[model samples]
Target chain A: MTATLDRPTAAATGSVVGAWRAVWLRVEGRWTWYRRHWTASLLASGLQPVLFLAAMGIGFGSQVRPGPLTDGVPYLAYVAPTILVSGLITVGVTEAGLPVLSGFKWKQDYWAVASSPVSSGQLFGAELVWIALRLTFGAAVYLVVAAVAGGWTSAGALLVPPIAILAGVACAAPVMAFAATTKGDGHVFAAVNRFVVMPMTLFAGTFFPVERLPLPVRPLAWISPLWHGNELVRGAALGGLRWWPALGHLAVLVALLVVGIALGRRAFQRRLVV
Target chain B: MRSDEAIISGTGLVKRFADFEAVRGIDFQVRRGEAFGFLGPNGAGKSSTMRMVSCMSPRSGGELRVLGMDPDRKGPAIRARIGVVPQQDNLDLELTVRQNLQVYGRYFGLTRKEVRAKAVELMEFARLTDRADHDVQPLSGGMKRRLTIARALVNDPEVLLLDEPTTGLDPQARHLLWEKLFQLKQRGVTLIITTHYMDEAEQLCDRLVVMDGGKIVAEGSPAELITRYATREVLELRFPPGDQHAAVDKVRDLAERVEVLPDRLLLYTEDGDAATTRAHDRGVRPISTLVRRSSLEDVFLRLTGRTLVD
Candidate 1:
């Protein structure tokens, strides 16, 4: 009892160090869970990307001809960076979907955390930071595998992983905001995957260029974070993207990331604080 | 803080939801080093009041102070100094039993070394040292409740608030939990418990408030409440179907009060044996008769005109 009385009130003190320490504790919880379950995630985020690089770049590359649509490069090199970008978008959507839902509804772990010294906004911020770190690590592994498979045509391909992280979090933040507001079982997540995630992955120019699609459906690709992500990755890896167009893509991804985080933080407070 | 000051106090405290009011305006104070309770039925706003006191929910209207701080302004700080065990078990099912304690301690800003030591100590206190590495999902109901209580103690909080701590446990488990709570009280950790069990209130709380329909109907110690609102003994008589109403009129003049139920008639009086004799003298025949001391259950019945558990 004396120890309790003598302890400093870090939560009320409101220092920068104390605030960051609160958020770091929540991130450690995610890291602990990941340490125990890394193998399953490695299979999905790591090995699966290499297999797609092999099947689409090597096996399917044999029939494709290098032309204006291919950026005059081989199919393997052409598809490698964009596939890495697309894979991370998928990872972001996966991370933001059922896991966020379980934290609020199924497991109610968010309420448990809310009862502690950590605030609801801090919990949401910590989640975004953890996802960004996970996406960075997964992107590094895919880059190594892509390099070994001769997926890059230039030295600038090394810059693609960081850009992939931006797009990944850009995709994760809004999805996390949506998950925080929803209730009940995970059928809504399935609908998000089918109607939202899959369409962006397929039509956002992962397998082919967006110009190949009909004019009416082309604007759908323009609005997707995956398309902006693909443009940046393709330019960085293949070395033909101009500076002005690259800035436009960067701005889009950043706006999406910022807006998603704001919405997610508000939703978290509504669900957990009450 | 002085020992004489109220550890917690609420004056005209009210909690209103969007469409309905949960805790109507009420006032209460809890002194240091004492066990306090909110005794009521399921929807009597006990949990709502507990939530407000725990700093988890904002008060709709009124003044509340915990540890001399306003909950709305200092929620995180107030929450840091107090422990909370919610109605349901919200253990992290993904973590092991030991990991659950260690990780939860980190939320309170404990060092890794401190959390490690605290985890070992708390696991022993909860009697969960043997199952330290097991996941929380497979634990029994009793083990889960014990673990929840142990987790709440990680920060060595000044006040521990438990909402229906032993609601679904068996008799053996309930007794074990009661013993643990008694030990905590002995160590001078202020305990605030909300429960519907009359025996639990009698066994744990030094003073309690009886709540009904979002209002406190009465407030006193268990013996004081039973002595004031009820007679010394209750005489219960079982009769045939539809015969209780007839027996009520015949025995109405014998006791202080007569309560009719579907299966039996209760006669409240100073002496149950004398009441039974007077009913017998009135030519009223009962199939069975029982005499017992008045309890908190009888007090609740007298105040609310209903049973506590029904």
Candidate 2:
């Protein structure tokens, strides 16, 4: 067909739309890569969650009593929702950060995509979508384990999927932005986990309320995704949503997801367009 | 893509890495169904030009059109319609040969059934039907390269781009790849290839541009280049390494042109037989003598003042 008219004129309009469609296909192909490797996913998603639920919820629940520590509720029930949110954070971090970087540089997965018709923005979107799917697997399995541990006091605990998804989006946003800007393996992510996630999981009312922390340190709970997800999950599970505060937490996570995806898109454009 | 009148055309194409000029300034055109080649050595900017043409890297400065679409703006459209065989085999090591084709076909937006059919056909074309389900990691370098070529063909591109298409392959592999490419040409597929081998240029390219240090030093058909820049035949002389310079000086005027190297002497002449007689009359007894028809290598050496291989 190039012999009749001109060739360059046709390509300009096509590359963008082509890039978008190509990315989705790449996501499908990458996901299909683990079909035969289901044994690993089986261990991580099915078995690991049950083990964690038993050890962290049942074993540790016995050590901490109700009322003074868990607002007079069963310790296992109180800790279960918090762990569900934290589990999302764990899976989201792995799927969004290290894997993203490895695909782009270390493993040269991005090179394979770039050489194709796919654009970088589209690939990044597909990457996020794939991560979201992986997060769902872990979150759903953990929610089932939470239910089996008798974590629910209200029927609304069935809304675990939405709550966990929101938690994942909220948690994945900053990590996505940070991943886009990452050049080499930086200690910044490691520090975020150690100084931020670890402390937040330990102190941000995962086991008890923020009021139990030092009077001045209670505000630290506002910045953690774990706190927001915890509030929503715990509020629904224990039949005690503050209404206004739950909406506020949900809004913060939405904003973070927007910012993260936007930043990631821009970074992909900047890095790949050259 | 445009009406496919001009598969590729460029005006004042320039590509540079920092201040280093990879392609200083070149203007060219490639019509559909034609086979074009860039014959140059390493550091000759052949790969750089190929990259720019493929729209993977931006041109430093130029007016370039591929399939009548601006490469800078419509990279995906151009790429979708083109098949690329890079110098190195960049096959997906994680997938099977059939899956590699299937996945690459999907990247071009082929439907599921379309890719499946394409995979089967490509595996047969590459003669890897038996290894279609095997992981690509264990495949030989030649098999991998064939699969890469097969993957490129999944999209059924109008124009194909190849860079050093058979650089490291054994003769059998190179012959098979060449046969496949020839078949594509017969089917009216436009091909743009870059290579440094004289024989490869002779066997494939209808027209070629010879480049050295980012600038095209000459441009012609394989035979035309030899006729223009080199004699019809060449006489080679190998002397003791230590006395090469003295031997070259002793027989400087015996041939039409004399190129003195550290270990050998190249005597360019219209009749290599006459040159041999002249050398013999001059009392020059070389360790060895080889007289053969001139080739692109001679033309390239004559224009660039250096050998093609290191």
Candidate 3:
């Protein structure tokens, strides 16, 4: 109080592009929080993916025969890229769940940000960006660990992290839209874990090829964004992806991400600005 | 062209929530570098109006302007030049005290270097330099409120909107906060505050509007409103709890007006001593009697026929 500074003229910065820059600024806020608590998130983004690789890929792979279903590759090599994508998806879903609820309802940090120069749409974009960054970090850690575990067969495996990030966004965007509309303490996140994410991770060709599943339930794997992501990452890592099929899987993930972002923007606007 | 002096102006502003109208078309203007206040009870739409001015809530109808820009279209632009301290402390509890200031500063497009320097200045200004690295969750309510005020100042805003700035604060904390606000006023920061405490309005507000039932019932400076709606002094007569009603009938004509409360009767008059002596001469035999100068509380009660706070 009674303090003075060289106050700059308050013309809105960047006019048109300022909104986008504000989105990054909001992401920067989350990054500050993440920098302090990244270790806490390590168990979810790092350890869990490595544990799954050890338990399902290496431990269980030792018993299974090298067969045509696994395309003559070792089980650890076959499942490594898929688990990377799965780990990102899990991180995406969890990030979009309670944290989104807290932003809207409990903590209301979204409202606080909206009170500033940032718009609700920009804030939503920033949240997705933060989630994407987390996915990228998780994917990087998983890729390094998997590479050391003899999971890499081709240089195309380097493309897995980006593909995993796309998969995470595809899963995160819609769940964030749903989370934006929630009012309770996020009990639905548990249901999303048990009924949606867990099943998708298990049945979407992470452990075995979807072709091995019963035909009736095979459509679920086809419909799951995780499966498309797994296909893209595995095809890239294993160097077996056909051109048209790969494009089709990429298109599906992109469509889901686009639609989810559209719906998410509307939900956030209603919750924050309205 | 709009007047540069009028930082905030609203005409026939209305706010409705489904079936209920929160603000029923009120008009007001706040000039540059002046402390303006909305004094109202809990349901009196002060917060609703504040939200609209802050550009966080869209108005249901009518025209509103902040810093000469329409809030409906220029929300982010208008919000960029102003700071808002909401009724509740929405400070980021997970972040350290300094981080809270740094993060909020970045939202205004301040660079990390600028924010860091400003955070240091603000921490010192709020007298929280010692708690700079500590998490915000452990700070006292006064510290949080002070930090919020400091955060609001990060943008060097042209106007600062504070809703119930010291509602839950203790007496000493409230005084400290008021001292800070008074300093802000001295520094030429336009302040818009909403509170039910008459003393807060009288102490901080250069001018204020008394609102009730979604409408402004009175508008003037504290002393002006007191003079217009209340007497210069008031005499309080307590004649046992149950006898207050009976006592009102005896001293009804002794003062300009008589108000009967549960445990006491208030006599509004220009001269409290004269009224009290006249009441005693009439054999009123009051259990206790006291005279006090009229306050904004008297003005509010006279305008709305109820206490400012329930």
Candidate 4:
């Protein structure tokens, strides 16, 4: 009896370590799922962005081109940052709200994770990191396609990648916090996409310059992370940075990222530990 | 909290959900490495108590300590040492079986390399090594449950909590699950399960508590409870409609106890054969006679005064 009693004590530490390794395994597993049915992810994230680049870059770029939207450059270069930033936004928003909720309600995955040694903060943090990595993949794809389409300039355009990532985090961070508290009939996520996402996409200058909007509407654009990403990525592409405003904009993104992280941690504990 | 001793201890445990009281008040201890069960029909509040022990839901009234620590104050610490198999599979349908184990391991902060090694080990343990790479959505129900168990053990918890682990499964699946649970118990993993099926309670639980209307009706080993609360043998008689009462009076003196119902007559006694013989000697013949040993179902019925909800 004594010998048997001592066995579980020895196994406890090993189990703790084992539980810690489980989070990334979830992401690796998701990769295989995506590979087998690549079209599903492709339709939602990859091909849709590619099509946006084609339609907006070629079709929409035609009207604004040989003019001044790109300041004598091509229209593709003008909208490239917007597409990249918008790409990140879509990932963060979709991943944080509906997908996270699915983990709670549809699948027992979150409960399974919670039952392990893992803290709610760790789970939330890991998911956000995974979401960030996914955004990078999507943005990189858009950037490569943009460069291949004769839209490349100086190496400074590399700024679009991080800016795009920031935009996605900016949009996703607060929404993730909000999603943890929501308990409606679930169709509310659709409304968020329509009202929140669509307006951010349109007014935050996905297709045009925010400066072109009326003064009152521009403030709404200013509040959006898409605008900052649009500003930074567009600035880097066309070499148009006002040092103070650009620095200020980056700081806001960083601040929001921190707030999102803090809020996500609190929300996860509240929902999971309940 | 030792492996061979009680790891979970509770005193005056009570759980209340607003105006309703799910677990009004109760106290139980689960020794390490024993297959303990909370057997009850629906609304018996078994699930509610389970939620408290799991550290998922807060205890409304009493003190609950698993692994010798209060879950309310040290939630993560307690959960870290426990493995939980919820009533549902809850496996990530979007991932492969291997990924499910790995991701669950990562939530506890395991390194990538360690998670990989552990995933392989768990898949083998779950008997799903061949299906390790297959999507979870396509696995059979039995396979899913095996995976869920495998996922729960990813952390090698000190106490394993399973709520109605075999509820919806077919007999073959339930038996397979029982076999797996038996192996866990053999390895000295403390098990706490809740089940409505008395047969499952008999087969898996070493000791269990019978619950009805949110209170414990009885608690003991399967054999002890059956003997204490039920007859040693049960005689079931089916008669052609209106003749059951006449047959009942003739057999009433043959047994220690008798219960008459709309469908059948049950004679409770120490010797069913002797009782049947005496009934026959009295020329009270029935359409059918079934003699069998008393089981946990009979005990549950005796204690609860109600049939289980399917």
lDDT measured at residue B185 in model 2 versus the true structure, 0 to 100: 81
Task: Give interface RMSD, per candidate.
Answer: 5.2, 6.4, 3.6, 5.1
Candidate 3 TM-score restricted to chain A: 0.94
* Model 2 TM-score on a 0 to 1 scale: 0.88
Interface DockQ of candidate 3: 0.46
Residue A44 in candidate 3 has what lDDT? 83
Candidate with better TM-score, 3 vs 4: 3
Of candidates 4 and 2, the better by DockQ: 4
**For candidate 3, lDDT tens digit of each residue in B1-310?**
2324788999999999989999999999998878999999999999999999999999999999998899999888888888899999899998999999999999988888888988998888888999999999989999999999988888878788999999999999999999988877776678999999989999999999999988999999999999999899999998778888777778999989988877889999999999989999988987899999999999888987887777
Q: Of the candidates shown, which would achieve the greatest lDDT relative to the real structure? A: 3
Give the per-residue Cα lDDT of candidate 2 at B300. 87
lDDT tens string, model 4, B1-310?
Answer: 3455667877778888768889878888898778899999988999999988998888888788888888888777777677788888888887788878876766555677877877887777778999998889999998999998878776667678999998778889889889988877887788899999888899999999998878888899999998898889999888877778888778888777777766678888998998888888899788899999998888877776666765
Q: Candidate 1's residue-wise lDDT over B1-310, tens digit each?
A: 5666798999999998898999999899998878999999999999999999998889998999998899999888888878889999899887899988888888888888988887888788788999999989899899999999988888887788999999999999999999988877776778999999999999999999999999999999999999999999999999887789888889998889988888789999999999999889899888999999989999999999899997
Q: For model 4, how does the per-residue alpha-carbon lDDT over A1-274 read when each residue is reduced to its tens digit?
A: 2232225433543344333344554455456556667677665665556678888887788777455655677888777767878867876788788878876777646777677666677677667777787787787787788889867676877888888888787778777877877776458788988988879888898888778999988999988877877888778878968899899889888888899989987987888875
Model 2, residue B196: C-alpha shift (Å): 3.0
> Tens digit of lDDT per residue, candidate 1, span A42-127?
87666666777888988898789988889999999999998888888888888898989988877878878887888888899888
Off by over 4 Å in 2: A1-23, A41-50, A173-222, B1-5, B17-21, B240-242
Q: Higher DockQ: candidate 2 or 3?
A: 3
* Model 2 CA lDDT for position B89: 75
Better of 1 and 4 by DockQ: 1
